[model samples]
Target: MHGPDRDGELWRRSRVAVSPDGDVVGAISVLRNPSHSGRFSVSLEVRPDHRRQGIGTALIEVARGLRPEPLPLSAKAHTTDLAAMALLQAVGGRIYQQCPGRRPDPTSPEIRSWAGIQAVPSGVRLDPLNGVTADALAVAWVAQYLWSHEAWSPVTSPDTLAQRLREGLADLDPATSTGAWIGDELVATSLVLREPDGAVTLVAETIRRDQPDGVRLVAAALARCMTLLGDAAVTNVLIDGHESDLHLAPVLATLPPTPAEPLLLVEIP
Candidate 1:
């Protein structure tokens, strides 16, 4: 069992079971989302010897008790983790989005060039996120909202969310990170990370739902980042939430197919 201090960091209580001789054999942690209305993610780990027992199911039941009713939950399962997948499925998870591992074809110059072409709407403008301002913070929050509705893991607090954004922005090379706005209201955002071998990855991209021509706004923002990265071969851009939103699906369909990494969302009644 995790002690109080460990439990605090996990954002919820945890339960552990030990063998008769006092060997720790299984553990599970439940976390509540500090930002969203009511959501949680439960993670479990069990020792090999404890397998085939009802321990995993019991741990989930305990975690479920920590939260209120009408809970919407989700879990990320590795493609190879058959046991974990089975457990999550048994608990009522359904695969929603898949993250496909892909390699950029060197012959696909057209695709790279397409990503670099900015199609900015007449009045919208793109800019780098100024982390020190309230406006930037608002934009970041909206971006986080978009993320929360997508396949992202739950966060425990506003402070944690702020810290994550700060760290993420600081780690970004200015030339590859950017945000967009119309007049003063932030509308779209996208980020790119360049690898040592001259490959680039599109880390996260979002456009406020209220924005007019949101999809175009996001595409323009991505194009700006791609241009700034300047010929750093984009290996593959894994666009999340594409399957849930048709707008995103069309955008992703433009790219080549590769290995799919499934993301499962669950809700227990």
Candidate 2:
């Protein structure tokens, strides 16, 4: 019963299903990650009345058909959403990562002391990625560090890294993403993404292998980002990386530990 939109842009990478009464009952967005090949993330929302109907399944079928071959799909759903959990399992999608949401206690004396300590070294410089000519290199270095240490899927090209940097930078309202430099070398980086529910999640953080001071630089950058978000009742600052990444242990000690969900990497034959 779905019909075309008058403006023709209703569901470009998504699909919409309308009931006979002209109500939009279901919708899902199919998105491709510029950094990862043959991978896609899907966001689905269904109206309450349409829940029992097979509309959700049908929409997923349509989404699958639209994807390129050897397609791999993934999504993030709340641990409490039984229906969605069921649907994803039925579609061969398993829990990739169970991130524990965390919040900052700005008034805590420990946090204050940690804040007071100069995490960044005296000689190193930290700044927002601006019109610097080495921006591409900086992005690539950070991306490589993240993929190698954090167990993230490989990002093969500098152009892909650049594209991801641009998209992530654009998402920040006050621009929280930053790059740290040791002279001309890009040594550390972090990006704070503000969720719709007012929680700021740290999406990615990477430090160069040889840069012993990179951890402090990353911590400093996150502290600055927290200040920029203001007094908005900030909750959980979620961050996840490989369990064996030792360079980040000092930084992780600063936050509360939530049980991490194991991510399964399946290569399609």
Worst lDDT run of 10 residues, candidate 2, spans 1-10
Please write out the lDDT profile of model 1 over residues 1-269, one tens digit for every residue. 24452333346666787889999889876665455435666677889978878888777777777754457654566667789878877776676545543333323555556665647888887787544264465456556455545443334356655655555444345555677777876666666544465444554445544556766776777666655554555445434443544234445556544445554455543
Candidate 2 TM-score over all chains jointly: 0.63
Q: Candidate 2 — which residues are off by over 4 angstroms?
A: 1-13, 20-22, 105-107, 116-150, 167-186, 190-204, 209-217, 220-250, 256-269
What CA RMSD would candidate 1 show?
Answer: 4.9
Question: What is candidate 2's local distance difference test score?
Answer: 0.58
Query: What lDDT does each candidate get?
Result: 0.59, 0.58
Give the CA lDDT, 0 to 100, for residue 214 in model 1: 61
Candidate 2 per-residue C-alpha lDDT over 132-215 given as tens digits, one digit per residue, 9 for 90 to 100: 444574465455455553444555445766655665544453355566677887666655666567655564355555567656
Every model's TM-score: 0.69, 0.63
Candidate 1 stretches with Cα past 4 Å from truth are 1-11, 66-74, 94-111, 122-124, 127-140, 143-168, 183-185, 192-207, 227-242, 245-249, 258-260
